[model samples]
Target: MTTPRRFDGRRALVTGGSRGIGEGIARRLAAEGAHVIVAGRSLGPAQEVAGEIGGSAVQMDISDAEATMAAVAALGPLDVLVNNAGFDDFAYFTDTAPQQWRALLGTNLEGMFACTHAALPAMQQAGYGRILNIGSEAGRIGSKGNAVYATTKAGIIGFSKSIARENARYGITCNTLAVGPIDTPLTDAARAVPVHGEKMVQAMKDGTLLRRLGTTEEVGAAAAFLCAEEASFVTAECLGVSGGMGISA
Candidate 1:
């Protein structure tokens, strides 16, 4: 069990916190006594989550650079930042459209840059911060027909490492959690269509040594650990919570 008051008095902003893994992370942090802000593209879901967790809500689209930066600035200062906003379009590299690539990259990789850029200064001034990025095992070991998504997640790891190295002196630690297949909104949608859904289900079973998909709360637990004080010495790392999926790759 997590110790009580682990994050007491700290403020954490979790992008995409309205549902799924992001919501799980927000709830976990809030339960641990952090003043969590559930930020998302829309207000209703975010508000629902915030209310349930006794946290706050912000409607901020991380893909929109200016708006995301503005929203972060308005938050004043934050003790923790979880870059969990991302989208994936499954298709072979040759069939992937330019629009899809743009949209995917905009949210997956660029969103990280925008939010981190805005939040870092405050962490620097305060001499402490925890930045946990939600990545994917698909990026570590490229998946079939998921090239764009994999590329973006791989970028997340590299970018976070650089941030950790540069800001370590200021006591701001940045790390990435490359997560495994989880029951998220995105996956749920994919798992709805009978043909592709069955394929996806089988893939999860075959890819993971555990022979089962993971849970959002499991991902949240890893995120909470990396963001907590106990993980101060664990920056610039890509911790794979992939249920043995990325053991070799």
Candidate 2:
């Protein structure tokens, strides 16, 4: 079966598009006929993904406010912006240090703010845009060791809603995807630890109704729909792509 070119002639920018969920979304968008700009901290990985997808690459470390704003501003008119770049570390609230908090907050929340702010002007000028922020189920249900990370994800929901409300008049839609545990390089590294890794993996699976972690492709598919023109009316919403992880909660 042939894929539909819903984004034909449209341009999209996916931050952290070097690997994992970001890479997945980039590939999906490209497959559906969108010109994707793969942005990441490193140039090589981003270039590789862009090469594979027939797109372009940009070095964008979202945590650097000035650099992020400048890089995004240089993108010209962007039809879609996926705030997928984020940092996460496992630690209880009491155990987390101020430095750790700063790192996560800077990369996840502040970085999103910068990129969105920079992209809004172009979208507003065009009077058409789709913004998809990658959140996490942890934000909604809370995670034992990811307190700061969860906090950042929760902020994303509120941020996206406000952006939607303010930009709807300009034909821009902003939404978030509350993601669940997915099979990504990050998860793989976590699961490589001897005993704790096994237990953590099992717990994540047990939390979901599907009894398994989700895939990057699965996330990409959900993200694609929310960012597509068909979802013009679906602004300020937080869609779960979590394999029913918090269905009861």
Candidate 3:
């Protein structure tokens, strides 16, 4: 059977599209016939992914409001916008300093604000759009070591809902994808830490009903569905691609 090209003529921008979950989403959209622009902090990696996927690349540090705004504006209008760029570190609330909190907030939360703000006008004008924000299950059920990161994810849920409400009349949909343990570079790095790395990984796996980590492709599939035209009725919802995390077996 042939895969449906849900985004045959759409234009999509996936922030942090150079690697991990972002990269996965970009590839999925492109596979479905969308012209994707892979945005990242570095030009090299973004270009690499875009080249492979027959998409395009742009350097966008969403944390820099000015740069993000300019970059999105240059693209004219987009049919899909995936606010997947984010940063996080495993540290207890008390152990983290102000700078650490700022770093997390800037990219995970404020960055979403800048990118969404920049893209909303065009989406509204077009009267059709799909906005997907990458959140975390940690946001729904707080994690032990990711206090600030959880906070940002929680904020994303609220942000998505508000955006959905405001843009519904324009035929635009906004939703959050709250993911669980996924085998990505970020997770690998966390598990590479000297003492607690393996323990942390095991704990996360154990917490999920699946008793294992998820795959990037899994996330990509979920995102594709939510962003598809068939999902026109779905908006302001938080969909969990979380391997049943936080659920009792």
Candidate 1 local lDDT, residue 159: 95
Instruction: Output the better candidate (1/3) by lDDT.
Output: 3
> How do the residues 151-219 of candidate 1 rate in per-residue lDDT, one tens digit apiece?
999999999999999999999999999998888887876577556776976787689989888888898
**At residue 226, what lDDT does model 1 achieve?**
92
Order by lDDT, highest first: 3, 2, 1
Which one wins on lDDT?
3
Minimum summed lDDT over a 10-residue window in model 3 is located at 240-249
108-188, model 3: which lDDT tens digit per residue? Answer: 988899889999999999899999999999989998889999999999999999999999999999999999999999899
User: Which stretches of candidate 3 lie above 4 Å from their native place?
Assistant: none
Error of 1 at 14 (Å): 0.2
